[model samples]
Target chain A: MISQNSQTILNVQNLHANTQNTEILKGINLTVKSGEIHAIMGLNGSGKSTLAKVLAGHPDYEITQGSIQFDQQDLLALDSEERAQAGVFLAFQYPIEIPGVANSQFLRLAYNTIQSKRGNDELDPLEFDDFVREKMKLLEMNPDFLDRSVNEGFSGGEKKRNEILQMALLEPKLGVLDETDSGLDIDALKIVAKGVNHLSNEHNAMILITHYQRLLDHIVPDYVHVMESGRIIKTGGKELALELEKHGYDWLHDNLQNNAGATA
Target chain B: MNALANIDYLSSLLQTLSTQNPGDFPKDLLPENNFPWLKQLRTQAIDQAGQFKWPTTRDEEWRFTDISPLSTLTFKPAQPGNSPALADVSPFFIEEANNRLVFVDGFFTPELSNVNHKNQLVVGNLAELATSHSDVIEHHLGQHFKSQKNLFSALNTAFLKDCAVIIAPQNTVITQPVHILYIATQAETTHYPRCLVVGQTNSQATVIEDYIALQKPANSSYITNSVAEFSLAANAQIRHFRIQRENSSAFHLANCAVSLDYASRYQAVSVTLGASISRYNLDIGLRAEAAECIIDGLALISSDQLADTHTCIDHLQPNCVSHQQHKCIADEGAHAVFNGKIIVRPDAQRTDSSQSSRNLLLSNQAKIDAKPQLEIFADDVKCAHGATVGQLDNEEIFYLKSRGIPELTARNLLTYAFGAEILNRISIASLKHTLEQIVLNQTQHH
Candidate 1:
């Protein structure tokens, strides 16, 4: 558990969610605080991505029994856009292709929408172009990217970089990167990690959901949590990620079963 | 009941009138003129119009649109009134359109029109052309289009008293577009707005035909039946755009026919945004080898409005190419229909043609009917056609919402994107922007 004195950005208690009546997240309990970077690692079908989607208020999942608090507000009660405006940002693993809409226009609309919600003056197209270009430099994206359609025909690495670029512009209080490192090469992973690191601050928090420990090498996390069967089974320092990477999740499964037997 | 549900209303009224034993030519609608040839042409058209029945849902082409509301209405011929207070015409008037011909209530409005460089081209009334250029008008008018299968066109030709006529001479290049605007005013009246364009050999021209209403009429509905004919000579190039922005209560039917000579290039774009019940028929004929034609259309309708577009391209000679794409957006019980056909003659070998119809339904109640047909008799011809009808992908909607756009705004953006695909292809920048704004406005309601 994170310290009580620290400002908790997100708190999930016994969260249960499913789609089409098939339960995915059985009982997810986690706490993320400001200034902390948490890495959630799990094997396939372990509800890792589901946790991220559920946090973003995706309508596909039905929360049977749970409660989520973000910045001390009832996050679960808000819709997806409301949650987004409330400073909860999720960098999707698969960014959708929106044809016929310029990327710059989409980014400006999204930026202005969040800015207005924060009671800040929104930037127009010219100002936004200047601001977004500066951020694109951090990700080493080409200037032509702003002219193309949103994520249309973008390479996998380019899509990941685009997600991070959006995060840089949005500057949300709590950002969740779901499998952002899954499809990146080493070079793209470094650039993406650097972008995420540059955006991180003491006033904000981040949760990186990945299957590999490779991303942890670049964007180091303070806490590493292992999720299996929709629940966080173990929590440790960043060293745990390396150990899990070397030993695999089978060790943790055995350890979890043995501990349950001993307790029973 | 909604307008589309009672589809045969106006047709039934016309049927009643025809059964009452009145003469074939409705006396009040006929013109008293000196041109014997013109009078004979109208008489023949009226006789033909009475022989064919109004299309109903039973007809395969009109399966999705029900025109009962139009058929039941009792409408007289539209009469020109004191040019009513002008509605803002800035948006519809393109700056690049140097020569503009404005018609109000099917009558020419001289004060509202401006034609520059009179010596470069001939711009006059179609009726006047019967006297000034009778040989050309007699040879081209209503010759390319088969009016026996088209009732509205037959009605238009039968009452063709006034029309905007444009003639571009040989080897001339008109830099600016010739804009023909037909503004329908008054209610419970039918208007026949017509246009004839002739592009001579190796000439280049662009023509824009716009149909609009100053305001939505109260307590009554009007109808505008328009016919535009284009005759492009060998090696001539003509870019044509037709915009229909009538009042939602008005009924609009238009027929555009284009005849291309050897190696001529023709492009036609239609943007329909208004009218309660609207139908546009576009036909293009490639009479010589190497002729090319492109037809594109966009329709945005909601609130029980119904818009139908039917297009046909005939490949009469060898080595011709035609491409057609039509898009429709329907919401709130609105219905849209798109039917496209391509016919390749046996001698038209190596002819290339492709047609596509894409529709987006904004609501569960919104519906779209799309049919793309190809009939090829040439052994070496290549042709393909496709049609799709669907709603915005739920995943895409969710994706937008997750980025802080509200569901409604996200849906609007997606819908605009869907329609913008066609509008973005417009060669005229100002027209593209204006049409995009209209499509954006349509997205807000659904």
Candidate 2:
């Protein structure tokens, strides 16, 4: 639960983003405070993924209107890398495969870059090897994955575990999991949720963007928000997810249409 | 008039050649000890070269590359004793080479070369070997390369004398590679460097022919015509690498011909990075059954540079295999071309051959033309060929940037990786490492 004294980590107001002159996110508003977990559940084409990408500053999306404040700073002014350095991490739904670069080298470079940006001492290859091995144990990742190309031939579960491994290494202030539960088996989903739970603390917050409430079962969310047509249509406690799972999204869709017709 | 225009450059070069005195050429540029037969061969080649016309844009082989600049300029034969300091050649030198031959302007520089494994193989200057190892040299040199119709090949043979020669005797395996560095130092000068390698029966070896030049001059215009001939006896395995990293304003034309006997294997890799205009012609002839040939190449061109590679592999006997993979990266108005052809003769049944040419264009103005051809006269053969040219995937770039890597770093990494695909074929670990570093540095600079 988010206490009254908890400070806000991410605040958005009337966020609007579009691509190719077609608006995807008409207007979105959300507030994520420290020491809390918020789950954004939506059906297909409801712009949940768009919200995740816009938060990470994807170049393809244009923010025509609205403001995003992270740690009380203008998040819209920052580039993707700058936002990453400022403590925002987005776990992609589909990770990309870089063929030639070894996973260890890429992870080390990213780790050192962020460390140096924060004015912290960086680890050399040897120290990083030991440090990363320890982090990999949390995700049950095999040691051989370090020598292979980043996500080149990894299975779906392996790719998701790698993403969580990076999040554990970066230790960002706010973590956004975009459909992290997709393509994962029940056992793999449990491991991922457990890893995320282990990383969360009082100072860092997380936003879980998912389609199914099954993921929320493993890692219970403090608040549940229903998204429809690029906007948050409903907000409730943890029980809302169970209710949505029980009744499905058809009832919500019918109820929203009837409400709009009645208002007109 | 159109035909005349097609051979205009060749005609102009002939005009310049008609006034030359072939006899007045330096002693090092002629046959060793004035061998009458060798001298006669040179005379015949030069005579034939005089009648042949230089290829022009109208010719299918030279369609994408234009040699108008070479036709307009007057080039003098490069003289000896004008070599740059050792510091200038050190960057191109590999530390792992057991035997090395350094040639400055086509003349062997003994002071800078090192030959230590005399017991395992014979490595020395070709001119001296022509006199000392006459029996071994006469049977192989100039015997395998019979057709001198190609202008550049004829030119190189006509003016070649001080070449590098490596001979691995029967059952001999040279662990370390033989490195030959050919360096050019002057503008408006032409250098013809030749290399001959004979691997006897059951012999195995690797040879690296590295072509480089001194730092860029005010007028960085020169010409290098190089030729290398290899003879692999039955059961022999030879790996050859031809690396051309010359000055940006230079023009380089080279030909590498190989003849393989039964069960012999030959892998030849050509890496072209420097020179304003560079062209490589690779020809491999599998004369006996079970012979395997692999021809791989990579060209990285930028800033108005042009690099073209033409490869031909002939399977003359049955049960032979040939594979070719050529890649090119063009950026910033550069142009790259690849033409690969594989021929399976009528008697060469059960021949397996594969050819691929992949190209990446980094800029909108960059151009790449790749043509992979396969001709199979035999009924039972497995032959496949393909060509592709495209830009980097936007999704890849965005993915990299999403990981906090800058756009420039992501591009460089991707470009370097693309070139590394071919470099990975190199078996020498240190050479691969050095080439990777060069690829990284060069790609980042662009």
Candidate 3:
């Protein structure tokens, strides 16, 4: 629910990126305002995740043209970790396993890193442990999850929950969640959605890149953007997802062809 | 490798070693040592040393390792000098261990040792218990090693003056670990540190064999040719920890052979951290039915150093199990080699064995050669072997960097974690904590 005086958190102007001599994100233009949720729904290989990674300053992607503005700063000028410290967070689709590093250690490092970047005092282990446990309760996470290795033997749902837990810890300004709802059952989807919804407030924004509109029912989006072939083909309200759920994406493809025919 | 030059080096070393230099060499291997059998053993070892020329690169056994640096310097045997107080060697002591045998320059220093003789455990040097434990010593001491076969093993036995010996009697269970501390003091000297531990039937004991230098010199050069043999009788359980942290300029060559009898279990961990050029040969034999052996090793080397580990797990009888994991981490022009061979003999049916060698290279100049060989003669045996040589995973680095952690700290954390897998297996709390900190400090250094 965005008010009239809401500030702009993320603004992408014709962002073009390449990786391994292949252009992935071509001319992606969008604006995410504070206190709003935008769902970028697309099929596989439609560059939905690529846009998320590009916004997060992933090293593999080289921004060939255009720019991204986060909190009025040039996001492209920062490194990946610098971008993360600057409040641009990308929840990975598949979290990596770092053996011998406890989940609690990794989470606290992430939390304190961003906390100190924001000129806030860092919490000790005991204080951070208590704070993180309170956040973990939002996703119905077991306390034992902190003792194990980071995503080493976690189930698919547990790995996604850990990503959301990171989002809740860092409290990023713009959260670009790439395929967060891919590997979750209905119950896990509700729990993760509850956590994400609890984290969303009037000051931070979220761009959820998902394949299905089922996630939109739990955490309603303010706007829905349909992407095709590395570009957003259409932008509509939350009711558009309901239309797409009733009629498959082929309906939009045929409708786009008809509209182009009529306009020509 | 010039064949003629290698032969000359071998022959000269053999000549220097086989000839009796009574006045110059330490008196430990003298002709008149009171025990006629000990004299016979030393002479036999010398004759065997003559037969084995120095191993050249042409030898299939030492293909990846070139130890020609050892032949450049003339060597002198180490002598027992001034006795240091307990405070001098306390830094390397294990607080949990009750029995400690400190060997300075390969000679047993009884003044520095603390042995509890009333705990059904017998601990002494070779000369002290040579008569009382002569039956066990004569049967197992020199008989276990490949004296007639390997060059380093033969030299170690021929110069065996004083050896740290531990005997766990039948049905006796020694609770705390017995620390065998071997300290090398002088540079340009050759020292032979020997150890023989025997566990009788149904006996159990844990022993830590530590090798260190008294001084920390960047240019110190010494030769420590060590040999330790362990014989475990039926239903015996022996856990051995061998740590070699000599000076950075020292050449540490060692051979450890463990023989496990029927239903016995042997768990051994060997860590090699500091050495200019070092080679450790571990040969474990599961002699009888239901014998099991678990072997773990780590060789962390950096900066022009070379560390080589060759292990052979021989499964001699039926119903045996052997698991071996060896890891090597090399950085900044260091080279590490791991050759793990698992042999399942013909009669060793139902033998389950697996061996893995994981090597990590931190720089472009770092080199690693990991070779896992399996020779299974029994058709029904289960054997698995693999070798991996790689750098840190980029995805893991990206994962860490994405969490706002700097790239350098991420790399250091991952590097420490790689070596921590083996350090986690250590049982002694103090030793394990010390090693963990050492691994974190050394492996994570920029």
Candidate 4:
């Protein structure tokens, strides 16, 4: 459990987002305190990924209403790269493969972009080499990978690992992992979970969006939220995940349908 | 500008060609005794060329490239001259060639040519072979490609007196490539050269057509009108390479057409590095299902030179695939043009086609015009086309420079990477290596 004195790092109120002209997220209100691990679970068509993308300021998704606050500042006012510089990182569900851009070069550019935004001196290539080497050691990644093109031919597990590596290098205050464990194997899941666990600190927080309860067995979220349709239907402690795993989402889905029928 | 519209220039050019009595040439070069159809074809082509006027900028195809230098030249029909004594006027892989056919001033020289592998490869002049092997020549010659609306092709077919023909039998894979060398020795001269390659079912072969100018001291202008036709039978494969390195004062216009049968594969690779004004017309027709065609080419233009390539790939059968990629590097007042079109007929369903053209400009005065077009009539097909013309990426170059690489080396490395994608598709190791070296040398010199 997070301490009561932990400051709130993210405040989202009545948020609504859309792509083109179709609305995905209706009205979402959520508050995330620092140093806490939260998991958002939902079905395939629900707005879980939408919320993650909206928070990251993806250009395609427009916010129709409401406001998002990050660390006492307006988060919606920032662009995608600016949000990245402001200590907010979103692990893409499907990472883009940018050919001709080397992995090491991309990481260094991203790192310097964020660091310079914070008024920190940028590290030279040699300095960055040393810094990333240490971080890669922690994640158990091979150093030779730095020379390859960014995600050009990487396997699903390797791509997820590379995302975590970027997260480690940036050290953002709020890291949103959008379905990072979807395609990972057992060993890969353990390594990714360990990387996330080691990066979480008193000044940072994480929100894991997943569809399966199998991932929670390793990541061990402090808070769990069940989302249906376009909003969260239930919020509880860790045992709630175990309860849902035992009975399955169909029970809760049927219960919700019956409740709606009764109310009507 | 219609700079060559002066009637005086045309009259003077005709006079110069008629006055210079080179020697007695064979009037009955294409005999009517055998392959009489070829004689009729030549007469029709000459009539067509005579009726059509020289195109200027008013024509859509010649809008970007100017052919005034070609029209102003007094070009005479070249007769058979002595073979070039130097062997170095050949391509990179000439000595190891299984068969070499040398043509000097539009006439075949059998003594200087080498046909080392007897039964595996068949190489000889097209006119001579048409007389000796009339049955085979009449059946296969001029069966695939026809004279289009292009004037250069009409003229080439009109004077189609000298050409080379190569035939590989079924299931025979020649170990060494066949080389076709066409050397122009005199200026103020015109040469019409044609080559026909027929790969039988299950046969595989590579052919390199090299165009070179032997004498550099000639002050007059020259014109080379050429055509090459390739036919690939079912399950056969052919790799065709064209290397054009003519004189700086020369004008070269070439047309290449290929037809592929069921399950056949055809690849055309062109490297243009010489000539003051050059134009290449390439067309590939996928006539049967499951056929594949790839067109890969590159041009390095510099010093007031103009290079243009126009290609078209037609998918007439279902389940066929075609891919084309061309790159141009222009610098120092040079100009380059690329126009590629891919068309899929209504009955050609499940066709997967893609075309891309990329240009890199090194100087502010250099110019490039690239257009990639696609016309799809089938709804179930996948088609895409794209063209990009821009300077080098500043951020990428800066990143490399910061890593201790000099600015020039970084730029060269990035440019090499841009062209490496197409080079990687070459299956021949030695050819690929030679091309890489040429690209490196060109970039460094620029």
Q: How many residue pairs clash in each candidate?
A: 10, 0, 0, 0
Candidate 2 lDDT, A1-264, residue by residue in tens: 577888999999999999999899988999999989999998999999999999988889999999999998999999888888898998989998876678898898788888888899999999999999999998989999998888989999999999999999888999999999999999999999999999988899999999999999998899999998889998888898998998898878787799999999
TM-score of 1: 0.82
- In model 4, pairs of residues that clash are none
Residue A134 CA displacement from its true place in model 4, Å: 19
What's model 1's lDDT at B289? 96
Docking class of 3: medium
Candidate 2 per-residue C-alpha lDDT over B226-267 given as tens digits, one digit per residue, 9 for 90 to 100: 988899999999999888988889999988889999999999
1 or 3: which has the higher TM-score? 3
Model 1's number of clashes is 10
Candidate 3 docking DockQ: 0.55
Best-matching candidate per DockQ: 1
Candidate 1 has an lDDT of 0.86
lDDT of 1 at B262: 95
lDDT values, one for every candidate: 0.86, 0.86, 0.87, 0.79
> Between 3 and 4, whose DockQ is larger?
3
Model 3, B383: alpha-carbon shift in Å?
Answer: 3.7
Considering every candidate listed, which one attains the maximal lDDT? 3
State how far residue A72 of model 2 sits from its true place (Å).
2.5
Model 3 chain B poorest 10 in a row by lDDT = B1-10
Q: Could you tell me which residue pairs clash in candidate 3?
A: none
Alpha carbon lDDT of residue B60, candidate 4? 83
Residue A91, candidate 3: C-alpha displacement in angstroms = 2.1
